[model samples]
Target: MSKRKIHATDIFNLISLTDPQWDKHSRKFAFVQTTMHEEDNEYRSAVYIGDLEGKTIPFTTGKGRATSPRWSPDGSKLAFVSNRNEKSQIYVMPANGGEAEQVTFCKNGARGPVWSPCGTKILFSTSVEGVQDLQQDEEEKKKKKHPEPLVVEKMRYKSDAKGFLDEKNDHLALLDLKTKEISLLTDGDRDYGTPAWSPDGKSIAFVTNLEENPDVSLVSDVYVMDLETKEKKKITNSNGFYSALTFSPDGQYLGFLGHEKEFQSATLSRVWVTKLESGETHCLSENLDVEIGDVAIGDFHSGNVNPGLMWTEDSEGFYFLMSDQGGTGIYFGSLDGAMYPIHLPDEHVYAVSMLTGTHEAIVGVSNSTDPGELYHFDLKSQTRNQLTNVNESWKNEVELCKAEPIQFKAKDGWELHGWIMKPAGFEEGKKYPTILEVHGGPHAMYANTYFHEFQTLTAQGFVVLFTNPRGSHGYGQHFVDAVRGDYGGKDYLDVMSAMDYALESFDFIDENKLGITGGSYGGFMTNWVVGHTNRFKAAVTQRSISNWLSFYGVSDIGYYFSEWEVQGNMEDKVEKLWEHSPIKYVSNIQTPLLILHGEKDYRCPVEQAEQLFIALKKQGKTTKLVRFPEANHELSRSGDLALRIHRLNHVKNWFVEYLQKA
Candidate 1:
C-alpha cells in the first residue's frame, strides 16, 4: 500500500468468495476461493484446504481471470472458468488439487457452469457456435465460405479511437463430461446469455434474444431443452429482458430477473418467477422504485443475481437483497413478496450471498470509518460472526470518516433521507465550509456505504451532505418515477431543500461558503443547479451531460437512453430535449465551474465536456477543463488508482480555492 490516504479508491479487486466449493469427503480435501489481487487485474483462484492454504492455483494462465468456483455434486472435481488463454474456457481439476484439465474447447468461450443433477454434463455458452451453425454449409463452413465483393463504407461511429465496427453475437452450448462432446443448444440471428440447469438435470434453461429486430444489449426469454431428445421449448414469452435465473429447489417454478424495456423513461428491473409448466409469471417484489444496491449484481439484479438465493433448504422461500430505506440498509425479501430488515450489527453491508450447506451467509461489508470486511451472517440467531479481516494493513495508516445519518422533511411535507460527515479534525462550535455532494444517475442513490471522495472532502475541512432525491433508487417506485421527463424540476428542488434543511438544522455549516460537485447525472444536475441558482460558490461537473442534442448521436447508449430519459428522441421531441438541456441556460451561471471528462468515454463521451468548455470560454466565464487519457465513463468509481487520485485531488483543490475562508 502506498502512503496515500486510504479511501474507497485505494481498494482494488474487492470481491467475495462465499462458500467456496469444498471437497471434504476426499482424504486430500480441497476448496476453491476467489480473490481480487492487483497483481492480477481480474479475479484469480486460490485453493485452500489443509496445509495448502490460500495458494494461487496454476490451472489458469496469463493475467486473464477465473472465479465462481463450484464443485461437482459428489465433490470429486472442481469446475471454473478462465480467460488466461484470451478466451474464457471451462477447466476441471481433481479434488486432490493436482494438475487441472481443460474441459471446454468452444471457439466463442463458455460461461455460467452448472453441473448436471448427476454431475455427468456441464452447460455453458459459446459466442460464435450458434450463429456459425446456422449460416448454412457454404456460408458458415470456413472451407466453403464464399467471399462477396463489398464496397468500402463511409466513416461511421468513428471518433478519437475505435474507428469502425463489425457484427458480433453470443450463443449457448452444452458439454458432455463423459464423452467430451460439445453440442450447440440455441442458434440463429440472436444472442443467448445466463444458462442455469434444472434440479432434475433433465432440462437446461437459458435466456435468449430471439426476436428478429432485437435490441443488442437487451436480455432474452427463458428457453429449455430436453437432455435426452434435444427437443426445445420456450418457457416465457415476453418482450422485456429476462436473466439471472435460478431453479426454486422444487423446479416447479423458475425464478429470474424481469427487466422492462421502459419504466419511467429508464430501465426498470425487478425479481420475477415464471412457472415452467403453466407458462405463468408472477412479479416477486414490489417495484421499490430504486435500483438494486448489492455490489454482486454487477449491472443486473433481482432473482438469483448476487448473494444468490439463500434457500431455506425447505424451499419455502429464498432470501435476496434490495435497495431500501433510502439505499442505506440491505433488506431480505422472499417470494411471498414480504420483506424484513437484516441487521448486520453495525456493519454496512454491500452484498449478501449464501454459502452452500451453511446457515450463515458471506456478506461484503464496510462502514464510514471501516474498510471493507467480509463477515458471516447467521440467519436463525440473527448474529453476525466476523470472518476475514482483509484491510489490516490500513488499520494504522488510514483515516476513516464516520457518517451520521440525518433525516429532514422536504418542503413537500415528505421525509427525505441523507447523511452528513464532519471534517476529520472538526472543532466544536466552529463553523466550517460545506460541500453538498450530489449523486449521479438521477435514477441512482447515494447509500450509507464507504465512500472515499466524501471522506477526503471531510479530511480537507469540509462537511459533506448527500441524499437520495426524487428520482433516486432505494425509495419506492413512485419516488423513483417522480423525476421522469422532468429534469432539473422537482429533483432540483429536493436537492436545494436538502441544503436548506441542513443549514437550518446544523449550526456548524458556514452559510456563506457552499460548494457542489457530481459526475454523470450528478454532473447534469451540477450544471443545472449552478445555472439555475448562484448559491454554490464553486461547482465541478464530471463526465456530465450539458447539451442533450449533441449527446444523442455521440454517446454509445445515447440514442436509447435519451429517448428513455427525456421521453422523446431527437426526431420526435427536439424542443423538449433542448428545453431541459443545461447548456441552453448557460447565460444564468455565475459560479466558477470546473469540467472533468475522460477521453475514451463512450457513454457520456468527451465531446459533451468540450461543448461546455468552449461555451463557457466563449462567454469568458470562470472555467477550466481537465481530461483523463484512456479513461471511460466509470473513471471515478472503477478507474485506475493514479487517475482516480488525481481526479479527487482536482475536486478538492477547486473547492478549497473557492470556498475556504481567508
Candidate 2:
C-alpha cells in the first residue's frame, strides 16, 4: 500500500479501545479510546458511543483521561470515572450527551461505578485516609506546612506503579442520586473492592481478603451483604483466587472466574457459577483445556482491565475470550456447562461488550498486523461487521509484516508453538539477521496479537522469532505450570528449540548474526541464555531478576511467588535459588549484553540489573547498564512516552550494531 515500512515510533499513532459497555436498549454502546500525549507524558482517554450501523459519536470531551463507563438502568444516563477535576471521580450525565454532574468527592476520589437496577443509587469504590493520617494532614494544612513521615506497618506497603500506598485503603461506598449524598456501606481495617449489586437490589456482592493473615494467604473471596440486615456472608469456601463477580440476571447464581490454587499462579483461570441457594460451585469450562480471559501479551494497549463474564440477554449462558495455543478468540458458555465455538482466527479479543437485544456483540479485536479496532459480530448470522477503522489510514501508509506460525519439538519431545515475522518488504533468497524475543510473564501467553517491538525489528530488516514456551498460558494447566520449580528447565529449552527450528527450516535467516532480548521473566531467561550458550552475538535484558534471594523480599509478589514457583522460601532453599540464578553461571557468558532497567521498577528493581552488571564487570565480560529515571516496570507499555520511544530505539540500535559487527 505504501513505499515505506512501519516506523517504530508509529506506536504513538495507535489508539487503544477498552471498556465497552452496552446500553440498556441495545441501540448503542459506549466505550473508551485512549491515545498517548508525549508532551503531557500521559495517556488521554475519552468515552465514545456507536450504533449498530457503525456510526460513532463522542460522548465526552474532558481535558483529562476518562474510563470505566457504566450505562444507567433505564439507559437515560451514563456514569464514568474521569480525572478532569484533579482526581478520578464518578460523574453522571445524560445518555445522549451533555454536561456531567460529579457525584462523589471523597478525598481519595472514586472509581469502579456499578449502577443499581432501580436507578435510585450508584455503587462505587474509593480509597480513604486512615483516622490518624487524616487528622495529621488536617493539622499540617492548618499550619500551611508539608505532611510528616510515612510509617509502614504492613508487609506490603508499596506496589510497582502506585508506589508507597501509605495508609489509605479502598472501601465500598454508596451514592444517593436524589440527595446528592454519599454513605459508607462497609469499612474497617481491611480494604474492600469489586462491588456488584444483587439483581433485586437487596444485597451487594464484593471481594475482600477478610481471611486470617490476609497478607500470607494471597486469597480472595466473594461476600454478599444483606442491605436491610447489614450482615454479610461468604459464598466461596476455598483458598482460590477470585474476581470479576457478576450475578446472573435471574439472581439464582453468582458467576466468576477463579482457580483453586492447584497449580498456584500458573493455574488456568476457569469459569465458575455458584448457586446462591446451595453454596455449590460448578466450573463450566473445567475440561476446556484453555485459559479464560484475554492473556494476549503485547506492548501496545497499556492499562487495560479484563471485563470478565459478559452475560447473555437470557442469562442462560455467557460470552468470554479464551486464550488457546497462540490465538485468543471469543467463546460462549452456557448455564448447563456446555460450550460453543464462535470462530475468529489470528485475532486477539482484548476488550468486548455484547448487545443482547439483537443477539450480537461489539468486540475489540487485534492481530500482529493490526493495532486493534471494534467489530460487531452477529451471533445469529455468524458474521463479523467492522464498526470502526481506527488504524486503517495509518496501516495503509506503512508496510507491516505478518507472523507465520511454526511448530517445533523440545529436547524432551514436547511440542512448542511460535510465530516468526519475516523482515518487512522481504526479498527471496536474501538472508536477514534474526532476533529472538521472549515475553515477560512465565505464566503470560504470547498471543497472535499486535507487538510493536517485533514489528520494529521487522522494519529494521530483522526476522523476529517469538514463542510461547512451557509455563506460558494459552495451553493446558499442566503445560502452563510445567515451568514452576524448574525456572531454567524445559521453558528455556522450548525457546531455544523454537530458534533451532527457525534456523533449520528458514534458509533466509542469518544464524551467525543472531541476537536475543527479553524483559522481566524473559529478561531472566536472556541472561540465562547468554550464560549457557554463545550462539547469540548480543543480548539485552530489561527489568530482569538476577537473584531470587533478594527478589523474594524486594518484589511486590516476590515473597509468595518465589515460594510458589521456586517451591521453597528464600531462607529455606538458598542453594536452589543461587543454583538456577543466571548470575551463578556468569562465567560461561561470551556475548555482549545490555542491561536496561527502570530506576523505580520495584517489581524486578534496578538492583537486579546492578548485580548482573557488576558480576559481568568483575569477570571482565562485556556488558552495559542503562537506567531510565522515574520509570517503573511498565516502561515499555505505559511509562513516559519519550522514555518508551527511547527504550525501543536503544534496543533497536544495540541489535543492529552487534548483529552487523558479528
lDDT of each: 0.68, 0.85
For residues 7-115, write the lDDT of model 1, one tens digit per residue: 4344452333332333434422232344445553444554443211323233334454565566687877778777766667788877556777778766556766778
Worst 10 residues of 1 by lDDT: 295-304
* Candidate 1 segments exceeding 4 Å error: 1-9, 12-64, 105-109, 129-165, 216-219, 228-232, 259-268, 287-308, 327-348, 355-358
Overall local distance difference test of candidate 1? 0.68
List the RMSD of every prediction in angstroms.
Answer: 5.4, 2.1
Candidate topping TM-score? 2
**Model 1: per-residue Cα lDDT at residue 633:** 77
Colliding residue pairs in candidate 2? none
On a 0 to 100 scale, what is the lDDT of residue 453 in model 2? 93
